[model samples]
Target: MAHLEPLDPKVDSIRILTLLPRVDNPNSKELFCKLENRTLASKPKYEALSHAWGPGQATDTIFINGQKVVIRPRLHDALRSLQTGKGRSLWIDALCINMEDTKERNDHVNMMSYIYSRATKVLAYLGPSHSAFNKADMKEMGESYHYFSERNCQLISKSIYWTRRWTIQELIQAKEIRFHLGKGYFTLDNRFNSLSNASNGSWLDDHLERIENHRNNMHSHLQQLEVLLEMFKDLECEDTRDKIFSLLGVADDTAQELIEADYDVDYYQLYASLIDYHQSASPLQCRSDLFRSSTYDPEPWRENWQGFDVSIERSVRVIAFSNLVQKTLNSAVNQTPIPESLSLGDPIIARGVIIGSVMSIGETYDDYVSSWESNKKWKALLESTYKKDKDLAKWRENDAAFYQEMLKWDHSEVAAIQSCDTTKSYGYRESQDDEHITREALDSVTEGAQPRRFLGTKGLMGFLPPGAKEGDQICSFWEACFGVVVRKLSEDRWMIVGRATVSKESLTPAVTESVYHDALNYGTENTSYSSLLSRTGDEFWAKQKDLAYEALIFFKLDIPTLQKLTA
Candidate 1:
């Protein structure tokens, strides 16, 4: 064993751990290691090792610079597998970086993108071969296999190594990638040949194809950021900040200056800065396709768009707002009604169904800004006034009764009342006969009151209901647009928390049925709301009769406007 020294940060160089060939004794406790120093400026040739660090408690002793050092058991296995007769020089992050030194770790991480890109080759250690693999069976099968079984493919695809956040950048930046599965080693270019005699060839091939697809998609720097965010959303890191910092170097050139690796800054602050940077740098293109549906017309705002200026403190608010607006517009334009067969329930009256056309589309930043400001002011007033005056609640209850009375009158009578210009106060008018009051007259008498936007429904702006998510669909009827219900919310109620986007392209009956069934399956198996519904007992079921029947009603309702839009 050789004694290793601290890496010099001043020099743009890295230390590589060279694992010597195994000795004669198979059960030998001792292992040899030699430290090789290389600098990027000199363009040194080395292979980088990428592997997942398993449980910290399961450690193995390895010789580094003539000193015994503890490393993860998996790393030890990787080193043993890579060792050759002539020995091998490898840059493994765990061994190469001084884990005890925070500054050194940061410096080394900063150069990781460059280090991997410049490496002669990258060896991905996927630990032992899966037990399902048999070497001889694959040799006979040859290239005749059309597809690998999904279960077999998942063995490699779902491995912990692939789940790591850091390995993504490492694997992507490498000049060349080779996989080490147990004692077997193979490059992607010749992976088929290496797998010719293995039973798990198809599985390995599928995994390789996925990796190749990821690599190809990451060719664009901006696209890489998008991929990174999606691919690593569930991936874990000890320091949450590293979640963003680790990908900075591999991200677009624009991102380099936008965010800097700082241990002092909180992860949320880093995330906010990243969102702000992305919004400013790529305003029109959102990172997730969930927010960028085909029906959204960015072209209308393209010329006058001033771009989103998301603040670090308000990043979540901005993102939520943007998502809501974009999703509503998308769902409204691409409405899809349920099939007729799904509807078996009797028609039930739906109150407050506002119906209207989109009178004019706002196509500028100023339009959005003005609308947002006005809404904020109105919200503030409502909150402040309601908090101060308890009488407002009583007034609203009385107004609701008056509105119900107006609803009972004939259309001509209602029209006459709507056209009236009476200025009598609501309180004063309420003192008189109920038949004498008009809707317009009631409106004029109320202090600080404005006519409801949906009162007549001549010009209405569609919006998502509270708690709507990406996959929820919106259905348009002759009179109004409605959210489709996947499951029953109550015995007499169904949930349509948000509008779902329907694809414009037409599907075959079978495919359409399959999609609908899948949605139902998801609702039943995955949703928390579905779980609550299940526990509602016999009373809930008796009232609902068949909840699915009610769900079908919402899905099957005919919407001419939506049909034409899809058509």
Candidate 2:
């Protein structure tokens, strides 16, 4: 027999070894010894090897047997602790990749699977495994890993080289050994006691117990290896077609859905650009960093559009406010009470209810903004409407007790609005009368108040008292309605009349011209504004406006007005 030293000399604590069969061929044995004694005489030129290789080359790293080595980072730490100041040999896959050694790298890639299989105590240093492994940690988790990556997974090829794929079959076979199959084994601590208990003449128990424990540990290690193998199988094969198909199929659907939604145009554009780049990618050529670009910022467009939206929304709020006010005025105008009909205070109650409803639109919007973290424009719209309603609540005639009672009804309406999940009855109830009233208010306030172009008006029936304070210049009765009539009614000339709610405010001469201008220039707002004027003989206006107003009484004003109007 030829005298030879073992490939590595770092072994002291480990007693176990894998037996390799001697081959008949002298060259095969030489190659096997070379593979086994993977340690270099000196540091090999890695840069030359890496430079010679083209893309898609097989690569691997070799570790010498009996070498005190760390497979991964924490294992390096653990192995260092085992060393006593002597240079402990460590075989790291990263250091051995030989990036510059193209021929060696290519040859090593094909042998990686075999090299890893023969390794003793392959340390899977997943994370800093010098400490206990917490599988849940995001940074350290090796729960699942991509096998053949070209970009971020630069070290993946080396990792596969160190795994013992062939030994997994042996480990699976080891699971059925007597010690594991039966309860014939003791734990590591109990081995000594078990051996002492068994007589020297009957050493079967001690041997069987030790074998069982080894089998159990081997079984556990085998399971982990099987999972790791699954990551590497077919990774470097030509049949990468299936993987491409699987990934690309779902990606196409998601891209199509995003495009169809048309919600974020810039995001979709960026996604499409990335998809186009990926479809024509070469092996390992797809760089993850290239796709990490942000979509074009829509901040400028958002800012500009927000201004228009806010102006429109403000117009809507003003319309709603004017509507509430007009309803109060109309209610005060038609204060004729009926017996067995609901009290004047009942219509007084409805005015508050509708006011609460409109305010609740503001409240619902506020809640939406808060819940969705919507932008400031939406928040401002809700907040402004809320503030205006609060201001309106301060004014009153001589109905202090009635106003207090109305507050309860208003609260109930608000509660109902809050409970409503849909837009239909969030603030305004879904009644034919309420719908007509809202539409009429939107039309009328937008129309008749052009010079000081009010958004809209609300109507009620009772007449206002003549000695009304400016604050009490709001109608508060069964027949009363309210609206955000334009501020064009000059402070000096606008006079409060009966019940202190009616106001005779003169319009500027530009009222008709402004209404026409707005209608012609601004489509919806201006057209609706012009329609509010009551032409002396325009029977269509008279009928349509009156019919709409009368219908609103059924839902919002007092039960008497509803009964009379419907009657």
Q: What tens-digit string does per-residue lDDT give for candidate 2 at 1-567? A: 011133344421111212223345532311111112344343321111000011243332222343322233332222222222232233333334443444444334333322333433233321212122222321221322212112212222133322322222222222121111011111223333434543342333333353344345442321221122222233321222211211221122223322221222232132232223322322111111111224323353344233232222222222222223223222221233333332233121121111101111111222322444433443354344435544333222212333233334332222111100111111122222222221111222221121110111221111221121122222222212222111112321111111111111211222222322222223232323224343435544343432322111111323322222211
| TM-scores for the candidates | 0.50, 0.17
Best by lDDT: 1
Q: Which stretches of candidate 1 lie over 4 Å from their true place?
A: 1-4, 27-29, 140-152, 189-210, 217-227, 253-255, 284-567
lDDT for model 1, please: 0.46
**Against the true structure, whose TM-score is highest?**
1
**Model 2 CA RMSD to the hidden true structure, in angstroms:** 29.4
Per-residue CA lDDT of candidate 1, range 1-567, in tens?
125476556788888778888767865646688886777777777889988887666468888767787777888878877776677878888877776677777777777888888888898888876788644433222312222334534455666776566776787788788767666655565554544434554644654565576577564433445445544555655555566666766666444466676665543344334444544444323332323245444454343233322121121122232222223223221222434333222211111111222222121212223476654553353344345455556534443444344345342221111111221211110012222223221212344221121110111222222233223223322112122212222343323322322111111132223222322232232333345446545443454442332222222111221122122
lDDT of each: 0.46, 0.25
Error of 1 at 98 (Å): 1.2
How many collisions per candidate?
9, 80
